[model samples]
Target chain A: MDEFSFIDSIKQKYYKQPTLLKGVGDDAAVFRQQNKDIVTSVDTMVENVHFAKYTMSPFHAGYRALAANISDLAAMGAVPAFYLVSIVIPADLSNEDAGSIFSGMESLASLYRMDLIGGDTVSGKELSISITVIGYTEPGRARYRSSARQGDLVFVTGSLGDSQAGFHILANKGEYEEESYFIERHRMPSPRVDFAAKLSGIKRVSLNDISDGLANEVNEIADASQVTIILNEKDLPVSPQYPQFPVDLQHKWKLYGGEDFELVGTVAEDDWESVKEAASNTDTVVTPIGYVAERSLSSKVYLITDNGKIPLYSEGYTHLK
Target chain B: MDEFSFIDSIKQKYYKQPTLLKGVGDDAAVFRQQNKDIVTSVDTMVENVHFAKYTMSPFHAGYRALAANISDLAAMGAVPAFYLVSIVIPADLSNEDAGSIFSGMESLASLYRMDLIGGDTVSGKELSISITVIGYTEPGRARYRSSARQGDLVFVTGSLGDSQAGFHILANKGEYEEESYFIERHRMPSPRVDFAAKLSGIKRVSLNDISDGLANEVNEIADASQVTIILNEKDLPVSPQYPQFPVDLQHKWKLYGGEDFELVGTVAEDDWESVKEAASNTDTVVTPIGYVAERSLSSKVYLITDNGKIPLYSEGYTHLK
Candidate 1:
């Protein structure tokens, strides 16, 4: 099988969108951008840097690429529309492995109902996959982390630190039976599209998807909006999957771990009840871990721990550069 | 400067489009796609394989990435609007080298008035760049290469053989003075977007950008349209810059060289005069090179050289895997 066959496999599995005038098999894709505001993000995942073939299947790695991109769109409350993928298939890649990757990407695309419009596949020494996800948001209603205001209540969707715990389990080659959830959390975390869509209806929502850990995302929102975030460490949400790890490691992963695909944001205190009403009837669990405070020139992020208060830094998941 | 600095530098040089609801510095860029069909394409360039830092600066390499994507849009007669770039920068790359690449991209961006909407920067062993260009075409009017009719006249914009010759000159490290034109053709080939826009007004137009050598592109159109294409060697437009190479090398490069960024297309015999008039005022030089013939199951492409008619195969620049 060659590159064209690889494309054929993708085409066979893609969900055709009404707006797609032309999909794969052209020099470029043709699509109609239904008169709406478009949300776009690009992310690249290198073989070893993002995932290892030994730790997870190629299927999981490919799935992670789209998951990460869709997370960005979800943060803005955009509906996934179309995506273009470019893959540098490594020379040593087995056909079975490559097929697994495409199949994995197909699974995510079908789940999200987004069309795989255009992509390029080329041979290279190291495998890298870059995806450009296109989605649409309601014009002025798209949420941004930079809009958080003082006295707003800080909140997050779903459990935190699950991805890091999953990494720990896999790194130690834990028993297969007990590790599936953790592994899925780390390798196949889905974007909070439904949850974000639910909350996006409210106007005071300021959101950022947590890819680089909760602390880092908090710092980003605080710095962007020129506010201080005070998080109660005891209030941090951790998955039931973390019982196997020691308390210290669990806290470490919970506070500084990344790739969780959870979302962190701020909403006005008066609108919290409305957001809770919107969040109801969804799979996601909402938690208020902190509150937005007036800007402090000394420190932007702080955690209220059992031992006392501590400043939080953006030290989560720095890639090997 | 670090990767963030690189981003800041790009932010400083980018143009904000009126359709862009939000530009860079967000999780995902937001834009309003006017009610038109969008043409999208992605390309990745790897270091050493696509360009050498010795012969060309990092700026030119970065510039070439966007130029290549714009060329694909030009072929479809789409107006270049927005683009996103993802770079896997190698660690050994100096800050200056990285700066040069961004500046190079900025120059092209300013020239085209296309917004640099979003991008990502990460560390990898080899420097690789991927660009996705988004443009718009009047619905149902975007030119596709799969519409050439039998008996249609084939035409190409600008000269060929120059990029390959420029490659040869650089490969051999010949003096820099006399080879500047050829080298520039190789390193900084501009997309013929304006030229394509002029001819796209004609209905008989079936266009393909000449990234893969002209012969290969001809084969694509013929195969897609179920027709045969025969090239007249005497009519082949070799750039005057090719006198440096011997006759045989010149012919080989002209017939099989790639990265030309020229437009190869066909027009009905009745529409040739109108097309010529449309092309005259443009800076591009349009030349008639061949004509489409009724499909034959046996052969798809043939070259009418002085020696004899020969079957043409795709022998364009093959990247090293």
Candidate 2:
């Protein structure tokens, strides 16, 4: 198809927001904001590393790309406003597939009242997508990893290993895609933008979405805050059936298999009650599994097992094991 | 190299600005802005279609990618403040080469006083770079293509066809890369941000950067404003030596060849004197080559040549005998 028709197919299903002065067909998109600092995040998902046709459909890949950036906005306690979808696809990609990709993204954009502002589409050696999400948060209200303090309680929303567990199911073909509980979790991580929006009312919180596994994300907070985090293995919110796998493999996926979009964060011990109340109002299940303390000389993160306490490796948290 | 060290290498060479609340090593880059509307543009440059290693180095590719987005900001009359660099590369790219790419982008970012805020680095089949530029324009004062009026004078900055002329030299044999003017023209079309900055002080202007071609850009302005544009063939600022090529090919490059980052815009006929004064004060050359008129039954864009008056075709504009 021609470029104009291709662009029309994508723009035909857009959700135009009132805040947008202009969307596509302009030199640059224009938007107005007040009383909020803009929160921006960009991420790229490539064909084999992030997704494959065998693992997920083109529509899911498109949704996942936008979801990844939205996950970051959730971590920042920002409300979705607009996004730019920049995609590079193989020359031979069918027009139908291209339209599907945009349709999938439009479905999610519609959900959050976000406008698809401006970006470029170009042909590349393989399918690769980069989405830049533009959001805004109240001044002095957005969460940050560096704000966690001593005596804070570390809480994580939802399950930790659903995405990775779903990934394993898709990678291996024992179960059908639709029948398995893991496929949707792996393919469509409904980013917690609403849950994050609720947290802006509460104060003294620091959070991050678990995209690079719970262990890596927890360590990032610990390192940024210069505090020590002790996570109780028994308290980790895992899928009910995941622990049935070989303990080592189960622990591997739960701690380090990445791609989960759950928000893990810390709240001051005194404000925990209010944070929980806000989460309850949003119907978001936030589970506290650890506590922050002063950092010692050795490690910033520790994982307690049935045997004893062991230091967690900062890099991937797996090298020690 | 590991992702950590690769990110660290790039982050180490950055020039931080006070407006940036946070940079690399966060969930998302944070910033503060007031009074101005946020201006955003995202563009992707693929490996072979946009650049080949034979014609441009990886460093040049990285620079050109950011330059493409910066050109959009220029057209919007926005002062570029931050940009997200999302890059996908083959797994085999060496650390030194990767560092070179970031250095090239950093050079441009430093010159513009723009912060390299947030993005992702992923593995892909071939090199692809997507840059999202975040800028701010004076509230209600940005130049738009829809604002051109009948009887307005259309102007272009510097010269056209240099980039395409430069492209032919790099694509074919004979001339080496260094000694010629066209190579740099092709490799680095310095975006007209300064010129646009000057125009921001002027009122009621419409502008766009020539990415696809001058004819395509002028047609966009005419179509958007619902007016007619007429070009004087003698007034077009072609490179002095470029017109020496065969007349047909010369016209082809001048009128149709893409990738020229020059600014094309229309201003009220009365503002011409003040606009030229602003351009000269900034050491920028503003050349008036056409005028906007009420649309008639003929083409929205026309070129007056030796043969006769002819409508400019929106697609490539190459239909003269």
Candidate 3:
């Protein structure tokens, strides 16, 4: 099928949003959202830089690309509403592979009731997918990384380091009974939109998604909020099978390895109970790993361990200089 | 400069939207657009497919990418507001080149008061840019391709094939007195957002942007509106230097050459004067080219010439099978 036919098939099969004034097959998509603030984010994943053809299936690539963007929306305390995808297909890729990519995105989108409003498909030297997601939050209530305050409890949702472990296993072709769990975590991370929505009741919260590793994310919150953060290393949450990996690898992955798609944020000490209640309501695990304090000179992040306090530098996967 | 520093520089320089609650340096950007319909469009340009290093400058590539997306919003009769850019940077690209790309977009963005809200930067095999633009229109006032009426007058804004001729000149490295005009046109085709905003006064207008050539765009409108459209060949608009090229090349480019970034639409005969006045107010040139008719069987588009009536096929640059 040609480009038009493929788009038509997608529209017929998946473009069903009654609230959208127009969706697909137009110069632009139109919709109306009254009385809510709009949150928008875009993420792009390249072939080898993000995922390899041998290591990742097309469906997972698609799912991961959308998941990364959706995680951003969740970090901002917003509800996923609509998304537009732009894919660059290499010559070697099959039509079925392309379709699988969309199917992968659709699988995640359906769970959030997000509409596939618009997108562009083109030929390129290698496969690349860029997704722009639009979400909604209450007026003046969207969370930011610059809102952390002294005495606030720094928390993280779900287990950390699982995705990195999963990726390591896939890259090395490791054989283990727990491989599927790691692979699934890496491939299909659940965006914490539900848990984030529950935290909206908090008067003020600071959030940053753990996409570029805990070190990088926490540093960002500290820098943005102009506060120092101290995390208890022993309090870091890990999956059940995390202990199977070497101790050094576990430490590295949990602290510096990224792509966990978990939420790392700070809430007031008084609101900690509300946060815990919200997490319990959503069946999400919440762990208080750190606390925010006044910055003496500049913002800094540190980890407290049995040895001593060590500086937590931003050592995540930075793309370019 | 590292990734964070580069983003920090961008945030300091270009992200200055007073209305945005949040901008760069966050997981997502937040803004509230009360009591308005949202319009969004995305466009992607690959290294070799859409442009080349030898033929286009970094600034022009960046400018053109955003221009294409803005044109889409214009066709929907919306006012351009905010945009997110996702760029895949090859290793060979210099920091200056990347900065130039954003500078190019900022130049156009400043003209329309558009905010550089959010985006992603990634390392890839080849240079690619994907831009998503968000605009706003009065509730229920956005135009659609499916709204053309049988008695509507088909019209086009400005010249059609200048961009194609300009691209030909650039690719061939030809030297001529009019070379700069064509080159400039090819590099920075103006999107008709102002004209589109003016056209909003007219009710029930059907519109499409000429990014896929006149024939393909008109065919799309015909197909979407389920009406027959007949274009008068003698009435097709061309630039002053258009006649310098061979007649066949002019004919082919005018019909099949895309990327003019002009608006093509149909307005009711009663609203024709209103359209003309709107164009005049915006200092835009408007020309009547054809008329919409009842579809006998399937919707079709045809060109009326001295030779006879010829069917217009959707022969634009379609990617993939």
Q: Which candidate is the best by TM-score?
A: 3
Q: lDDT (0-100) at residue A200 of candidate 1?
A: 60
Q: Report the lDDT tens digits of candidate 3 across residue range A64-114.
A: 889999999999999999999999999899999999999889899999989
lDDT of 1 by residue, B1-321 (tens): 766777887675445567777788778988786767888988888887777776678989988888999998998888898889998888799878887887788788777789888898877778888999988887776887788888899999888888888878877865544588888888888898887777756775888988878888888888778788988989988766566588898887777778888989998999898778877867678899999888665438888989999888765457422
Query: How are the candidates ranked when ordered by TM-score, highest leading?
Result: 3, 2, 1
DockQ (C-alpha based) per candidate is 0.71, 0.84, 0.91
**On a 0 to 100 scale, what is the lDDT of residue A155 in model 1?**
91
For candidate 3, give the lDDT of residue A71: 97
What is the lDDT of every predicted structure here? Answer: 0.82, 0.81, 0.89
lDDT (tens digit, per residue) of candidate 1 on A135-253:
87776778887888889989988888888777777787646445878888888998988888877668878899988888888998887888888999888887765666888988778
Candidate 3: pairs in clash:
A1-B321
Q: Write the per-residue lDDT of candidate 2 for residues A1-321, one digit (tens) a residue.
A: 766667766773455566677788889998878778878989988887778788778898888878888999999998888989888868778888977887778778788888888877777778888899988888978789988888899999988787877877776667443336777888888898888888777777899998888888988898788889988888898877776556777787778867779999998888888778877888888898989878644338988879888887654532111
DockQ, cand. 3 = 0.91
What TM-score number comes out for model 2? 0.95
Candidate 2: give the clashing pairs: none
Using DockQ as the yardstick, the better of models 1 and 3 is 3
